[model samples]
Each structure stands twice: as structure tokens, then as C-alpha cells.
Target: MTLALSVDGLSVWYGEERAVHSVALEVPVGKVLALIGETGSGKSSVALAAARLLPPRARMEGRVLVAGEEMSALSGAQLRRLRGEKVGFVTQDALAGLNPVMRVGRQIAEVFQFHRNLNRRESAARAVESIEQVRIPEPAAVARLYPHQLSGGMRQRIMIAIALALRPPVVIADEPTTALDVSTQADILRLVRELCAELGTGILWITHDMGVVAEVADLVAVMYAGRIVEHGHAASVFDRQQHPYTRALLRTLHDMRAGQPGDPLFQIEGQPPSLNTVITGCPFHPRCPMATSLCATEEPVSQRFGGLEGTESGLVACHHLGDQAGAMT
Candidate 1:
């Protein structure tokens, strides 16, 4: 089966600073791939690069194929057409994603106008349909209201509705349900999963929430310092994480799950290295507990794990996995 989205050796740089380095993954149609990492781990950068939405100052390299088309090769007009028509995006900040001055209905209908040859009435009808599909109550009234009138959850739902209006084959959602109550977050994620399954849309879900990943992800890619450190079937990655960073994240989640009470939450120590600094070895070495002297001098190439049957493309970038086999366990 052809992948809905395939990224190979993708890298992005902001002038002299590299934000992401050689990240790659594939999202098959009807599958949900979660890109999980803490803030500033280049999760959002990866999402933007996939959609060809990176800033003017940023330079990108490598292949980003969406629906068999090379996103990086598309021209201005072609890329514009592909953005909303072939690939949709729901940004992390719904308030910023939506136009404050425009009516929510018109904002959504604009997608139809841009991607489809629908008149005002037809576009309005379709926009209302999209809104209802995302489970927004009183779709008509919600359509008539401005972005300011809606609650945070409602705004997020509207963002999703707008994104799905054109039925794009790939959806890149950057923390689409953040800042909502637990109940609302569940509802939003369920709606996204259901809609993607029904439409066979590939979803690249960028988030830091492991709970959400456990609920919706078919595959999981753990990113750090702008590169994918570990990727595999979501179940396997959760059950048997390999990379030290991935293990730390899982331990943090376990701490949260146990309802550990304290203002001082557990976190990986040390800050991420500056993008301008040339990282000779693993970018995660400074904070990695299992890092060896070799890890500080040589970069570890991603390698497929052994002892796993029916697994493909599962990779971990680490030098100590051989010696620290029992660390994650």
C-alpha cells in the first residue's frame, strides 16, 4: 500500500541554525502516527516542514512526499493548492489558527472556496456540515459566531472542522487538543480518530501527551534535538522503549500515572544543545543517563531492533542499547 505521507532524511534550518535533522517516517493511509516529545523538540517544525509551511528564514532539505507528490518540489501556486486541498493542518493554537475578525463559518467556508468550486450558499452548507462532523453543538449558531464567542474547546473543534472540510488525504495536527479539560481532550481526540478512520486520512499527530498517544496512535515516533530517536508500533514502543530519552519520557509518564504529588515534577535534566553548536555525537548525550564515552564522540546511526517479529521500519538511534538492554526493563 502506498503511504499517504513519507518523509525521508528531512532537515530544516533557520538561517545558520538547524532546527531538525534527518527526521523521517511514513504514515500509511487510515493510520494515526503520533510525533511525541517535549516542547522545542522540533515536533512543530516537523509538522510545518511536512506541509511546506516553514517560515521564510528557514531552509528545508530532503523528501516530503504527500499522496505521492513531492511537497518540497511544488511551486508557490502548487504548494498553496496542496496545503488545504491535498493536506490539512490543525495548529496547536486554535485561537491563533482561526481568524479573529472573520466569522467562524466564513473562515471555514473559505477553505471550500479555495479548494472547491463552491458558491457562497454551497460553501456555507458544507462548512456547517464540517462543523457538525466535529461534534460542535448548534453548528448553525456556531458558524454565525466569531472566534471570540466560542470556548477554547469549541475553537479547537472549529479548527478541526476547517481542516477536514476538503477531505485532505493527510492531516498534520500540532497539539490539536492541548489546553482543554481532560473530558474535552478525550472527545476531541475521539472525533479526530473517528473522522480519520472513516475518511482513510493519514494523520501526523504532534503532541507531548503520552495518554493521548496511548489512546489514538497506531505508530509512535519519539523525537529529540530535532531527530527521531525511536519509532515503532505504538504498542511496542510503549511496552519496550529503546532510546534513553524515550525511556525517560515513559518514566515521567509513569510518575504522572501514579499520581505523584509535588510541584517538582520529574524531568530529564540539562537543556537541549544550541542549534548553532555542531553536535559531534548524540545531541541527547548531555542528559542521557546511559550515555557512554563513545556516545559523546560518535553519532549513533538508527538501527532496527532484533527479536521482534512482524516488525518493519522500527528504529532506535542509540549506542548503548546493546549494553543497557535491561535499563528500560
Candidate 2:
């Protein structure tokens, strides 16, 4: 299968402070790779940089390959052509991402206009088709309404419709289901999974919710302190987590294991390190339960246990993997 996106040695800096380390990832065609981490762990920074969407003051290094283009080397016009045409982006907050003043249908049509050079009638028809594809009720009516006039879920579906209108090879969904009710969230996720599969679109799903990853992700890459601490198949990563951080995040989930009603939730001790602080060894050591002198002064080597690349079961980064049988799920 062809990979929709690939990042090699990707790193980003805000002035002298580094926000992302040498992070490498791949999202194969029709698969979702979840970039999981708590806030400030630099997962979003990595995803945004993959699309050349980082902030103005941020400096980036390494290669981001997508849609037959090297993102890091693209010229201004070429970069614009790549986004929304070959690489679509779905932001977290639909209400914020869409213009309140613009009619929903017109906004979706703009994507067709930019990439397809379609006339207004053609764009409008295609936009309604997209709205229908996303399963919105009465596409024609929704098309005429402004963003605020729709429910949160409707607005989100509209956003997804815009992304799908171009049939991009890859879609970057940054918490697209956030701020929605539980039922709405499920609908949005199902829509994304179904639409991407139908279109053969690779997805980079960035979220802090392990439950979301469990339900939708084919592969998982756990990020902490600007670096990937563990990456593997979603099943193995959760069933036999090799890194302390991955285990900690899993234990924090509400449904992972049975606990007393009065018991406090499990949480990783200590705070995530600030970007201003530099560490020579594993950045997570301070919060990791298995930290040692080696963890404090040296980087952990990545170990691949599987033969097939991108299979999701054969990888980990750690100095203390312990006995696999006894490791926390």
C-alpha cells in the first residue's frame, strides 16, 4: 500500500526553544495514525508542521512528504496548491474554523474553485453533493445557512465536507470531534472513518483521548515531551504497552480497568516538562516510574520486534521494557 504521508527527522523550534524533537511518522493509504499525547506534549506541533501550518516564529527541520511533494522545500504557490488540494486539514473547532458571515455552501465551494477551477454553478453543485455525502439532512437548505445557524455537529460535518470535496490523498484531522456531545462525537468519528475508507484517504488523527485512538486508529504513536516514547499497532500498544508513559496514559482512562467508585483516577506523577527546560536523557524520566540513572543521562534506543514496517505491533522506545507478560495494559 502507498503511504499518504511520511515525516522523517521532523523537528521544530520557537526561537531557541524546541517544541518538537526528531519525530518520524507515516500514515498509509486508507489508514489512521493517531498522534496521542497530553496537551503541550508537542503532538499538534508535529502535525501542523507536517502541513507547513506552524506559526510564523516557528523554525522547522527535516522532511515532510505528502501528495508527491516534499513539504519542506515547496515554493509559496506550490505550498498553497498542496494544501486543501492534495492534503486537506480539519481543524478542532468547526465554529472557529468556518467563517460566521459566509454561507456554509459557499465556503465548501471555495475548495472546488481553488483546485478545480469550476464556475460558480459547478462549484455550488459539487458543494451540495459533498454536503449530501457527509449525510447532512437537506444539503440545499444547510448550504444556504451561515455557520452559527447550524448545530455544532452540523458545522463539523460541513467542515469535513469541505475537506472531502477535493478528494485529497491525506486528511489531517486535529480533534475534529472535540466540544461535541457524546452521540455527536460518535457520529463525526464514524463519518470520518467511512468517508476516508471510501475515498482511500490516509488520516493523521491528533488527539489526547486514548479511547478515541482505540476506537478509530489503525496505528498509534504516543508522544511525550516533544518526542515519541512509544509507537506500535493500536492493539499491541494498548494490550502490551512497552513505555511507562503509554501505560500511564492507558491507566488514566475511565474504562481501562475496574476501580472503586471512591478511588481517585490514576495519573502520571509530576508535570510535563516545559519547553524552556533541556534534558540530555529521556524527557519523561522525571515522571516515569521506572526511571534510572541511565534514563536520566542517556536516550533510550528504539526496538522493533516485528518484521513488517507500519504493521503497528513491533516497536517501542525505552530502556526498561520489563517482562512483557507482566507489563501494564
Candidate 3:
């Protein structure tokens, strides 16, 4: 299977503080790879860096290839063209991503005009079609409306329409369902999955919602601090989680399903550490229930597990796999 997006040893830093560390992953065409972690876990940093949209204050290292084009090797003009033609980004905040002053139609049409060189009349027609593609009713009327004039869900649908207008080979979505109501969130999720699959577009979905991951991901990468702690097929990661953090996260998801309205919710005990904090061993050792002296003193390297008896393989960074397995028993 060919990859639509590939990252090898990708790292990002802001001045002296590192936000992402030696991350590696791949998004195969027509598949969805969900990157999930709590806030400050460097999930967004990895996504933004992969998209080559990092701010100037941030510095990046390692290689990122999108649609088989290495980002680092592309000239400014070439990079811009690559982004416009082959990459689509659906941001978390639809309002922030759109031009407030411009009608949603014109904003979506601009992509066709600039990248595909469609004239105003042609691009305008295509914009309406794209809006309809997202299942937004009354596309022409909605297209003429300003961002502020539309409801949150409508604005979000417009964002998706704009991103997919060019049928980019790769789509990077940053928490696309953050603030929508439950029903609308489900609608948006279904729409995005259907549209991407139809277009044969691979996705890098950056989100904290485990429910969202379970819903759409073909593969999953769980991040902690700045490193990926667990990664594999979504089924393996969720059904046979290897890392302590991954297990804890799924426990939270279980709590959501098993709890009542008046019941107290389960949550992880400690907040994530700041990027400025110094670390000597596993970044998660301070909060890991399975942590031991070894976990505190020696950083754990990633070790492959599973692939036995027809099981899918996975990578995990944990010193006490044997102990964790025993605990699970």
C-alpha cells in the first residue's frame, strides 16, 4: 500500500523547549490514522509540523513527505503549490480557519481559482457543488452567507467543503468535532469519513476523543508528553492495549459508557507535565501506576509485541510489559 503521508524522526521545538520528539508514522492512502492524546501531549505539534504549517518561532527536524513529495526538498513556490493542490486541512475552529469578511462561497472558490485556474463563474459553481457534497442543505444560500451568519455546524461543514474542494490526496483534521452538539458531531464525523473514503484520501486526525478514534480510525497512535507511547491497528490498541497509558485512556472511555448521569466520572490522577520540566527516564513514570525504579531511572525503548497466533503487531514503550500482562490477568 502506498502512503499518502509519511513522517520519519519528526521533531519540533520552540526556542529551547521541545514540543514533539522523534515521532514517526505513516498514513496509507484511503485509511484513517488517529493521533490521540491529552492536551499538551504534542499531538497538534506533530500534525502542524507534518503539514509544514508550523509558526516561525518553531523549528522542525526530520523528514515529512506528503503525496510522495518531501516537504523539506520543495522550494517555497513548490511547497505552496503542493499544499494548495495536494493537502487539505480542516482545522478545529471553523471560524478561525475561514475568512470572516469573505462569503464562504468565495473562500472555497479561491482554491479552485488559484490551483485549478478556474474562472470566477466556473469556480463559483464548483463551490456550490462542494457545499452540497458535504450534505449542507440549500448550498447556494449557505454559500452566500458569512461565517458569523451560519451556525457552528454549518460553519464546520463549510470548512470541510473548502478543504475537500480540490480532492487533496491527504487531509489533516485537527479536532474537527470539538464543540458541536452530540448529534451534529456524529453527522460531521460520518460526513468526513464518507467524503474522505470516497476521495481515496488518507487522513491524519488529531483529536483527544477516544470515542472519535474508535469510530473512524483504521490505525491509532497514542501520544504522551512528546513521544508516541503506543501505536498499531485500532482494534489491537483498543482491544489488547500494551502500554499503561493506553490502558488508562481506554478505562476512561469505559467509564463514559458505564457511568450514569449522577455518577462521578473517572479521570487520570495527574495533569500532563510541562514541556519545560526536565526528564531523566520515562516521561510518564511519575503518573504510571506500574512505574518502578527501572521506569524512573532508565528510559524505555520501543519494543514490538503481538503478531502471535494471527494477531496484529504493535509497538509499545514500556519497561514492565511482563508485569503489566500479569496485572491485567
**Candidate that would win on lDDT:** 1
Instruction: Tell me each candidate's TM-score.
Output: 0.93, 0.92, 0.92
Query: Residue-wise lDDT of candidate 3 within 1-329, one digit each (tens)?
Result: 68889998999999999999899888889888998877678988898888788888999998988778788666578777777467888777888899999999999999899999999999999999999999988999988989999988898888888878888889888875346654576677678888888889888887656776788788899999999998888988988888989888888987755655434333777977899998878988999998999999998988877762233677889998767667777
Per-residue lDDT tens digits for candidate 2, residues 190-262, read 7898889989999898865566678888888998888988887888788777788888888788753354443
* Model 3: lDDT of residue 283: 89
Ranking by lDDT: 1, 3, 2
Question: Per-model C-alpha lDDT, please?
Answer: 0.84, 0.82, 0.84
TM-score of 3: 0.92
Error of 3 at 6 (Å): 1.0
> After TM-score superposition, what is the CA distance of residue 310 in candidate 3 from its true location, in Å?
7.7
275, model 3: CA deviation in Å? 0.6
Question: Counting only residues 3 or more apart in sequence or on different chains, how many pairs clash (N, Cα, C under 3 Å) in candidate 2?
Answer: 3
Clashes of each: 0, 3, 0
